[model samples]
Structures are given as C-alpha cells and as structure tokens.
Target: MYRYDEFDATLVAERVAQFRGQVNRRLSGELTEDQFKPLRLMNGVYLQLHAYMLRVAIPYGTLTSQKMRKLAHIARKYDKGYGHLTTRQNIQFNWPALVDVPDILDELAEVEMHAIQTSGNCIRNTTSDQYAGATAEEVEDPRPYAEMIRQWSTFHPEFSYLPRKFKIAVTAADRDRAAVKFHDIGLRIHKNDAGEVGFEVYVGGGLGRTPFVGPTIREFLPKEYLLSYLEAILRVYNQQGRRDNKFKARIKILVNSEGVDGFANLVETEWNQIKNSGVDLPREEIDRIHAYFASPKFENLSGESKTHKAKIAEDKEFARWARTNLAEHKTSGYSIVNISVKPIGGIPGDISDIQMEAVADIAERFSFDEMCVTHEQNLVLPHVKKDDLFAVWSALKAVDLATANIGLVSDIIACPGLDYCSLANTRSIPIAQRIAERFSDFQKQEDLGELKIKISGCINACGHHHAGHIGILGVDKKGEEFYQITLGGSGAEDAAIGEIAGRGFSSDQVVDAVEKLVDYYKNNRQDKERFLDTYRRLGAQPFKEALYDAA
Candidate 1:
C-alpha cells in the first residue's frame, strides 16, 4: 500500500540498471559463472537445479491489486505460467531464463517491486502479520514499523554483508501469526502501563540445523528508539558472530554461545551510545508512515450480515468455506477471507498466472483493491464485505482458488525441495501432494482439525518444519531419500521447537506414517482437542510409539 517516492524510485531504477549490466556481462562471457554468482545472488537471482529462480519481495506481505496484476503479467511473460509463494511471504518465479531476469526486474520496478535483499546475507524482507491493520486483536498495525525497518536496512553499508543472513519480524496482535519468535530479531508492539506505545524485543530466534526460540532481550523499548536498538543488535552480531564456519555463523549461535544475558548486555551497551542519535525515529516521520497504513473506509452496518447468513443457509459449499477460511474483522460486517493456494494434490504455494489474475480481479471487485500474502502460503482479502462473501467465493471457485482448507491437514506448507532446489536432499512437493491426496476428503480434514504439517527437503528448514504440529524433514541416507518426523512444534505466542520421533521413514512409508499418527490422535484425543494440544498433553512418546512401535 505504500507508494514509492522519487528517491525510492530512483534508487530502484539505478539498481535495475546495474543488475542489467551485470546480467549482460555474464551472458556475453565477460564474467564467468564463478564471478557472477555473488552478483546474481545480491539481486535475488539463484541458479537452481533446473533453472534460474527469481524471488520478488512483497514487503510486509501487503500488495495492491495493481501490483498483483503486475506479478501475474511477469509470471505469464517471463517465467513459467506460475509463481511460488514462499514462507516469508515473497513470491518465487522458478524458471526465469538468465537473460530475461533484467526484464523481469524492470517489470517489477514499474510496480514498485524488486528482488533486492531477498537472498543475500543481509536483512531480508521485513515481514508482519498478514491481517495487521484489519484485525481487532492487535494493539496497533505493525506494518509501519516493518516498513520503517525496510527503508532503513535496504543497502545499509554496515549490514550489507553480515556473517549470515538476517531476518526481522514484527507483530502487534496477541497471536503470533508472523512467527515473530523464529526471526533473528522479533519486535512485538505493545502499550506500556502508562498507555505509551513501545516494543518487546526478542533476539537470536531462528530455524535451520540449529533451531532456537529467541529470548526476550528488552521488556519495553520505546518506539522512537527502534532503529537505534536494531542497529545495536546488528552491530553486536557483526562484530562477534562467527565468520570462519558458515554453519555456526548465525546470530542465534552467537547468542547461545554467549548466553542471553551476555548478548543483552552487549546490545544495551551499544544502544546507550546511539539511543539519542539522529537514527532515532522522529515523531513526525513515524506519524507519516503510520498514516499510509490507516484503515480503509467501511460502510456502517451491524456486526452480523443478514445477507451473509442467508447465503450460508442457502449454499452448503459457501457455508463450509465461510467456516474454514474466514477470520473476524475489526470493522463490522467485513470479514477477512483466506484463499488457500494448497488445493488437494497441488503444490502447496504455486499459483498459475490465470489464477493470479482472477484473484486480482476478485480483490479489486470485492476487497477494495488490496490483498495480503500470508505466511501460511495463502492469499487474504482482508476487508471483504460479509454481504459480498458469496460472490467472492463464486469468483474464486471459478479460478479453482476456493479451497476451504486453511488449517486442515491438506493445507500443507512445504519448500521447493529436490524438485527445484539445488541444496535439497529429496523431493518435498510430491510428499506434500501425496499427503494432501491422502486426506483429500474435506470432511475428513475437518475432522482432523487445525493440524499443521510442514515439510522441508533439507535441514535449511525453509518450509518452517520446526514450527509445525507435525514436522517432516527429508534427508539423504546412502543415496536414498528418507524423512524424519517431529511433533508438538508451534509458531504461535507460546512458541516451541518440535522434538523428533525415533527413526527415519523411507519416502514410501512417510505418508503412511503421517496417516497413522493422525489416526492415533483422532482415536485417542479427548473432546475437541486439536492435534497440537493432544500432542502436547500426551507428549511425543505416545505418538512415537504409535508411529514406530505399532505392529
């Protein structure tokens, strides 16, 4: 929703020109592949197993219908007819030709989008809750702060090349929809006892080979010092973080090695010197950014819509979708509708060009021309009027985007594993597809209830396997692909890293193992307990026994 000013536009244009020159040099043989590797990565271009992949940033997961149309155009013209939405709320074009990357970047720049800082060891796209401004539970919208961090960190000379990649997430809601605790720096916006707005800062949270739920470093930091505090954290990490071993280069490793108190003291010492510096955000600037995220106009209406109720009564399909895919909105008579990209047997986050265009049209016609890319690999019309729900559902159904499986077993989150990623050990998409097909029945999925299954092709954990209720990790064992399972992981406010079950399962046995665990839970759960609640209550022992020890 934030438009680029002349400075922002000029900066992006210059970067595009630079990248175009770089691409031309590589193509012309002036630069070898070795020489162009860093350059390409800096521009969010990666040479995958099969082709070049381009990742475009969608800041804080917010986009206009116009921007969505531009993405659809790029998917149609430059890459394959589809784009993959990543766990970070960015989109990936997996098959862009090396020569056409500049053109793709040019198209993206026209819509104030780019792939800058999407892949390199600098601060990646700053993400927030998809329903930041529209939800009633949040103390305030977190997007403004996320945007401010984005503007400050883009091409910051000090942090351009850290020991490892950095990520920051912000959340203002009571629920942690953005997985803030799993980020390098997580900021939770809250009001103090005196009613003044501030942040609760968490440091050193990340997931990879070594996963950690970041510890709270500061209980209350005033909003004005956010930039200064972040700078302090980065400075500490840059100076102390490991550079010799890439495996242990993350800030989480440093924090763990030095203990949370030691790290916090270092950050405090650094912050003391720069707390009042010019980097501290001025009140006017904060207000200006906040204004850009102000709520859209809504017609006065009752909390419940008669037409919506009537439509649900009339259409069973619409009623099911409403129950599974809709969230309560702050504005009365308006609901947040989640469009699940994970249809049964389909790739978890892949959206075709036609589907993208259809969604754009639907957002423009019914959701006031704005949409959000969620961390759960779904699109959201955050302000759809309740009265217009049925029409929107019909339109989405026409494009095959009306899957009513938001948090069900079929709505999986997975990475472009061995199918696309060069670093992957085994295929992830097929496993996800098979699992979805296994639980294809909507009634069966509803019966399963709020089950999150996340899979990663490797230990990179790009699919956020560590945070799922059922986490599956693919591994290479003597040139064969196998999967390891973990249970009871969560990414909400009470974040916890999942504990692994006993032995690995071959690809053929993995899906059946998952099914067995689900069935065990269904048979053993009390009342309406979700899979995660049951797992936590009974611990992983029972599930592990059911998965491996059962005859």
Candidate 2:
C-alpha cells in the first residue's frame, strides 16, 4: 500500500530509460548474449527455454486495483495473455519478446512497479505474510518493516553482488504463512514479556540442493535496531559466504559450515561494530513508511454478520469455499479471502489477463481496493467483509477463479519447470496438474485434510518442495524424468525439512505414489490429525512402504 514519492518515481523512470538504452544496444548488435545477461537480469529479465521472461516485483505481495489493471493490460498487450505468480510473490510474464522488454518496463513504471532486485545475486524481493494488516493473530503488521528492508537493500553498494541470490522474509503471526523459515533471513516480529515490539531473527535458512531450517541468530532484536542487525548478518555472509562455487554460495551453506553458534557470534561481532553508526533507518523515515500502512477505516460493525451465516447455510459451494479459502480478519465482519489460481488441472500459479482484471474488479468493489499475492502462488482480498463473501465467490466462480482448495491437496505450489526454465531437468507444471486432478474431489481433499503438495523442477527449489508436507523434486534419471519424494517438511512455526523417501519415481508412477501416501495417511492417522502430524508421528518409513511396496 506504499505509494511512490518523488524520489521513487524519479529512480524508476531513470532506470527504465537506462534499460531502454541497454536493450537498444543489444538489438543493434553492440552486445552479445553473455554481455547482456547480467544487465537484463539487473532489470528482472531472464532468458528462459523458449523466450525472455520478465519478472515484476510486488513488494511484500501488496497490490492495488490500479496496479492489477496495469498488470492485466501488460499481460494482454505485451506478452501472452497470462502471467505467472511466483513463489516469492512476484509475477512473471513468460513469453515477452526481447525487443519489447523496455516497453513492458515502461508500462510497469506507469503503475509505480518495477523489476529491480527481482533477480541477480543481490537481495531479491522481501516477502511477508499476505494477511499483513488484516489478520487477527499478528503482533504487528510486518509490511512496513519489509518495506524498510526493501528500500535499504534495493541497490546497496556493498551487497549489490552477494555470494548468491539472497532472500528475506518477514512475518508477524505465530503461523508462518510467509515461509520465513525457508528464507536466508527470516524475521518474526513479536513482543517480549515487557511488550516491547522486536524481531525474533533467524539466519541461514533456505531450500535448494541443500535445505536447512535457519537457526535463531538473535532471540529478540529491538525494533529500531532491526536494520542494523540485518546489515550485520548480511555483512558477515558477504564476507564469509562461499563464492567459488555457485552451488555452495548460499548463506545457509556458510552457516552450516560454521556452526550456528559460531555464525551467530560472527553476526554479533559485526553488529557491535555497526549497530549505532547511523546505519538504521531514520526515525522520521520509519514513521513515514508506517503512516502509509495505517489501517483502513471500518464501519462500527462489532459482531459477525447474520447474512454470512445465512449464505453459508443456503449455499454449499460458498460454504466449502469459506471453509478453506478464508482466514480470520482482525476487524469484526471482515475476512481475509484467498483466491486460489489453481483449479482441478490448471497450471498452479497462472492467471489470464481476463482473470486478473476480474480479480482486480472484485478487489476494488468488495475489498478495500487492495489485493495481495501470496508466497504460495495465490491471490488475496485482504479485507473483504464477511457479508460480501457470497458475492465475491459468485463473481470468482463466473471467472473460473473459484477454487475452494486453499491449503488442500489440490492447492499445490509448483514451478514452471522444463516447460519454461532452461535449468530444469524435468517438467513440473504437468506433474502438479496431474496430481491436482488426481485429488480433484473437493470432499475428498477435505477428508485428506491440510495436505501440502509442492513440486520443484530441479534442486533449486523454486517451488519450495523441501518445505511441503509432501515434497516432490524432479530429477533426470538417465533420460527419464524421475521424482524424488520427501515427507514431513513444513514452512510453519514448527518448521522442518522433509525427509526423503527411498528411490525416485518416474513421472508415470509419481501421482500414484502420492495417492498411496495419502491413502496410508488417511487409514493410519489418529483422530483429526493432518498428513504432517501423521507423517511426523510415524516417520517416513510407513509412507515409504506405502509408496514403493504398492508399486
């Protein structure tokens, strides 16, 4: 919800002009692909398998109807008719022409959006919980802090080139909807016994070839000192993180090499040196940023709406959607509504231009003219009144966006794998679609209960498979596409990496294997237990047997 100031507008405008020149130079044959690669990446352009992909940053996953409309227009006129919402809460235009990228960026700049820091080895977009201001269970909305970090990290001279691409996530709630545990730097804003707001910081957590839950580097970092402490962590990683090999360049790798205690000690030493050296955001700037995020004015409706209850009683489809896709709102008579982009066999994170416009219109009319993109690749209307849920549901269904499968088996997180990415060994979207279709039944998915199925094309873990209750990683087995399954991983407060079940499955056998695991969970789970709980209690052995013995 932060608006661009003069400085922001000027900076973005200047960058667009600069990139336009660069693109012209490339088209004129003054630069080769190798020469132009880093330059384009700096502007969030990627050379995918078939075409150039343009990733636009959605800082902290916040969007306005105006911005959404701009995005839909871009999708319609510039690239394909759709955009892919990524796991990092950014949107990717997958089929843009190289020649038209500058024009695309110009359109983006019109909406106060850009692609800076969305790619490259620098600090990428800082993601936060989608329900930042609307949720009831947060200590404070973490978006302002995330915005503060975004401003600080945009083009910091020292960290412009990190050892690897770095990620940071912020969350204010006990339930980790932002997957903070899997980020390089994860900050949970909370209050101590005295009720002073501060961040519980974790460092070196990431998912990829090597996945690990970050260790708590600081138990309680004072709210004002957040920036300084974060700089300290990045400073240590910049100085110590491996750079010789891209595979081992992540901060998590460095943290694992040095013991957690030793790593924390290094960060502490760095902090002692720079904690008060004027590195923190100015107090006025902090207040200015916080002011933009002031809560929306709400009517004095103090209780739940009878209209909502009546609708749920009358409409089973609406009721089903309410059960899975809605979160408790901090304000009475309001709900945080999730718009799942995943249908029965649809691509996981894709939305057509028409769908985008429809959701934008829905957000504008029903919500407070605000929309959000979740880290799990879904849209959100963060402040919808409960009374409007039925209308919203009806509109969404008409646009084919009403999928009552948030957090269910069909609500999967999958990356565009071999179909798009040049780095993938196997296709992921098809697998995700197949798996979703396999468990397409809404009642059956509800029976399965809170199962997370994540599929990544490669070890890079773009889909965050390592953090799923059922994680599937695609790999090349000779010439065939094989999936390695892992169980019990989570991105919640009780974060843990999933353990691998023995032997990879071919694409043909993968869905059946997943079904077998679900079946075993259904049969063996204790009263009302979820897949993760059952897997944790019994370990991966039972699931492993279920998958392979049946095969």
Candidate 3:
C-alpha cells in the first residue's frame, strides 16, 4: 500500500478541517440544507431513506491491516457496528449521525483514506483487481498506477463537477477481473513487442440507464504520456460531454451519441498537443510510486504444503472451506484466502463488528497484517501461509465468516437496491438471499460449477447484472416489482453485454425463474462446461423455453 507523503497528508488534513467547518455551519443553520447539499456530498455524506450514509473510499480495493482496524473502529464508534462493502470496492456506513461526519473524515485522514470523490459527479475512486499484486498472471502491480491516478484526480479543479460520476479501472492480467470494459476509462497494462510497458486505453465505457463496453481509444498508449493522455480525454469530456439531462450525463451516453471513432478522434486530437508536457511520467517518479508496491518479503518454500493437506484431511468442515475459499498465491506456501460475506440466507456484503475484528485478527496473526476487499464484495487475506489455513478457518468460522462459496451460485453480487439505495427499483438483498438459499447445498453448488448470478436493483447495473452468466435486473412496472433476465454476459477478456432472455418476471416468480434457467442449463450442458460455456454453446433459446415453458 502507498503511504501518504507530506503533500498527501497536508491535503487530507486540510480537507477535514474544511469539512468540519462546513458541517458545523450546517448544524448551526449558518448553511441551509440546500446550501450544505453539495458540500456534504463532496465529503461522501448521503441523506438516505433513514439517516445519513457515509461512503469511504478504499482506493483500488487495497487496505492495510491497520486501515481495516481503523474502519472497524469508525463503524463501531460513529455508525452502526457494521459497514456494507459496496460493489464499487468502497465501504459504506449505512447509519451515521450527520454531525459526526467531519469527525469520521478526521479519523479516516489518519489512515490516508477519505470520503472525497466517493460521491459527486467528479472522478470517483479508481479501482482494480483486488488480487492485483498477488495474481499469478499479472505482468506487474497495477496499484502504483491506480494510486497515481488517485492523486491526480483528487479535487482536480478541471473536473470537480463533471456531468456525472466518472469511474476508472485498471487491470494488468489477461483476465479482466476489474471489469475494465464497463468503466468510464479502462486501462489494461501491457508490454508491446519492444517490451516497453504501456496501457491499452479504452474510453466511453460505463453502466447506468445505458450500458456500453468501452472502445479502444489508443491500442497502445506509451508509458511516458499516461497522465497527459488521460488529461486529454477528461478535457474532451468536460468540454462536450452531456449536461442537459442527468439521465444522459455519463461518458457512455456521449460515446453512444457520437460513435466510438468520433470520440477516439477527439481524444487523439487533444492528446497530440500535450504529448511531451511535464505531465508525462518521469522514470524516477514511476520508481518512487512502484517502491511502495514491491513484492512482500516471501520465504522460499516448496509448492506442496503437507501441513495444509493434513489439516484438510483431519477436518471435514475445513475441507469444505478449502475447496472454494482458498486460492493459489504467487509465493509458495502461501494462499489468497477469500472470506465470503454471502453466507446462505445472509446479506451479501454486510459484515458485523465482531466479524470485522475477527478478520483483522486473522490477517494480523496468519496473513502478515494485510487484507484486501474484492470487487465481488468479499474480504481477502491476501497472503495467508498454507500452514495457517486451519487456524484461520477456525477463527473465521467462530465469527460466521467461513462460508465456502467464493465463486459459487450462493456467492451473489447484489446491489443495495430498494432496501437501501434511493435509485433502486426493487429489493435486491432479499432476492440475493433467496437465490443463495435456493442453492443451500454445497455439493449441489460444486456440481453446478462456477456461476456468477448478479442482481442489480435497477438499470444502473451497480451489481453488474449485465456481466453475469445469469444476470437479473430489477424493474418497476406500474409500481410492481419485476425482473429482467439476461444470459451469456461476461466481464472478462471476451466482454459482452448479456442479451435479455425473455419477458420480465414478477418478484414472486423470479426465484423459480432462476431455478428453471439453471435447471435448463444443467440438463442441456455437455460434459463439465460451466454456466457461461453452456450459455455460449446453446444460446438463450433453450433457457427461454424452460423459463416460460407453460406460457
């Protein structure tokens, strides 16, 4: 993790003092609710259905063990005894007193984290694969670049008030775990034939009322001009991106209105003038940032872990957890352990204070004091030694965090729909719970194979329903809850939007409809093909037939 420099520290400290004053004013009536709206939003405070909700940024989904403890502290003191990890790789406190927000910001400042740019139409947190540095396939760590972007975009005067919120994602591996295709700006770090590292920049990608997979603006953007080229794209968006209607405000809408070629041309023309500017990355500066992300001190050890195998064989429950929760780490004798938040019949991403403390303790004791928040809304102990698997699992199980459903159907990604979000059309959490409960059997889930069942409460697609093997999108028809299903969608290297399977299903019919679809896939699938592969082979026709067979 990149520690805050003097400049970074000064800026955040100042912002806290500034917001403190603003909050006092609002409470004292010096500023009316209308007057304090933008100021509060800039600080990540939201006036939700019940009380105020504060969203704190976890930049690029990276957090130190200490930072995690601080967040848990904040949750314990200021808000409720729990926090909801959002789909955008941010942690949100659902209940916070409006007056205590400034205090919360101060606490976050101490950890080099903040709520700035978390809300508002400005550039939001730049996200990446939660397993970035640890992923075996990655060419290099992507966090240094993500941190660089965070510094540049923080309170950027030129883009403080864009037409809508801007999101950027970066991925270094061939697998697109960061959902680069669905971001306002997506960068895939790659090396060309010359072996010089650079980016494959994609622009005009986003999901909302309209969804668009970004187009490549530059097939290969040189490493030197990363910031300069990014500035060019933002400049174009600031100048010409839609502002007349909130519905048509995202960069994706602009790209859709003006073809991808036209948008790319505009970005290129702007970039040509700023190619050799001072904004270009200097080698020394790059090295300075990269130093923070150097590989952890790893001991040379054999791939085989007799201790781990022994434990797995000794305990049946531990064996079950080992099957789905553990992942291959870059270093030998270590594994990336996913702590699934989506226990059957439990809320998808809500973690209580006890669970938080348990996770923090495990990370400190067994994982060398580092943890990560995954985009799938799960917690990760990024570097757990294989020898510590059983002990960690026991600790996690004590806190009810030992669900062995990492990528299984029971592991669902659902947005805080009508239950919490003001933008949601129908309740998503309950629907997710129902789905998880529907597949309560662990062996049945494993037999079903890897399947991503994502549900978004609305068209904004916060849950990334469009990218799921089986996507369920909630809609409202005459004030009644309805869902639209899409199949064959993926957010990987071969990214594509899911086609709607058929007509919408009412809330009452949704679970059965999903069951029908899954059953159809299972019956028709050849060999051990996954849900996605089966969808690809047979297309949506068979699923549709099964879903609406009586109709």
Q: How accurate is candidate 3 locally (lDDT)?
A: 0.88
lDDT of 2 by residue, 202-270 (tens): 998999888999989888989999889989999999998888999999999988999989999999999
lDDT of each: 0.93, 0.92, 0.88
Model 1: per-residue Cα lDDT over 1-551, one tens digit each: 67898999999999999999999999999999999998888899999999999999999999888899999999999887999998889999999999999998988999999999998889999999999889999999899999999999999999999999999999998799999999999999999899998999999999999999999999999988899999999999999999999999999999999999999999999999988878878889888888888888899988888999999999898999999999999998899999999999899999999999999999899998999999998999999999899999999999899999999999999999999999999899999999999999998888888999999999999988999999999999999999999998998898999999878999999999999999999999999999999998898888989998753
Tens-digit lDDT string for candidate 3 (1-551): 89999999999999999999998999898999889889888889888777889999999988776788888899899877999998778999999998888888988998889999899899999999878878788888899999889988999999999988899999999988788988999999999999988999998887666778898878898877889999999999999988999898888888877788999898899889887778777899888999998878888878888998998888888998899888888997889899999889999999987788888888888877778888899988888888888889989999899998888999999998998888889989999999899999998998898899999999989899998888999999999999999988887787888889888999889999999988988898899999999988887788788889984
Off by over 4 Å in 2: none
Candidate 3 vs. truth: CA RMSD?
1.3
Q: Candidate 1 vs candidate 2: which has greater lDDT?
A: 1
TM-score for model 1? 0.99
User: Considering every candidate listed, which one attains the maximal lDDT?
Assistant: 1
